[model samples]
Target: MSISLEQVHPLIGNKFQIETSNGIMHLELVEAEERPRRGVPESFRTPLLLIFAGSSRQPLAQDNYFIEHPSLGKQVWTIAPTLADHAKGQYQRPHEDGSTCLYYQVFFN
Candidate 1:
């Protein structure tokens, strides 16, 4: 079965594995959920944000991968590099070592 955004929202702060050509890599759902659309009604269509975090060991700069979740099953997601707005400090994820990590954002209709 395919996985939906709603099925992933609740899994925030949890880890999920991705099947890659190299091997199995893992990532954590740092953020998820739909943001209130500017003009669209709350029930109509809200923007969804599926952000995943990974360490230097796992690189997601390649193509899409198949993500497998116990409840959500497996689904393919194309991840892209997301730049954290410097103006919006809240969107930034800083590490203890002063190195900011990379965050991949997935968009789906």
Candidate 2:
């Protein structure tokens, strides 16, 4: 099965384990969004883009990681560390700055 965001939408708000060089880490699917290009013609379906957010306690290096989900199995994603959203408040863990989670975004078409 392809590892596109469309295949993973059902697992939103769920946590999945990712195999990393450091070991296994977990990422929680926080949100998903699809935005059409402002100038794209209605006939162009491929122009629609999908984006989703995954939160994890352990920050990841800029690279692709194969994440495993109980139901969805494993899929590769290019994970890039993003600033923690202050709006979410403190997460389950405590970080040096007292904020517990960092975020990553996955993009697909």
Q: In candidate 1, what are the lDDT values of residues 6-85, reduced to their tens digit?
A: 77778988878888888887777877766656787656545677877766555577578898778777888787877654
TM-score of each: 0.69, 0.65
lDDT of 2 by residue, 68-87 (tens): 88988877877776664566
Give RMSD to native, each candidate.
3.9, 4.5
Which candidate leads in lDDT? 1
Per-model CA lDDT versus the true structure: 0.70, 0.62
Candidate topping TM-score = 1
TM-score of model 1 vs. true structure: 0.69
Question: Candidate 2: TM-score?
Answer: 0.65
lDDT of 2 at 49: 27
Candidate 1: C-alpha lDDT: 0.70
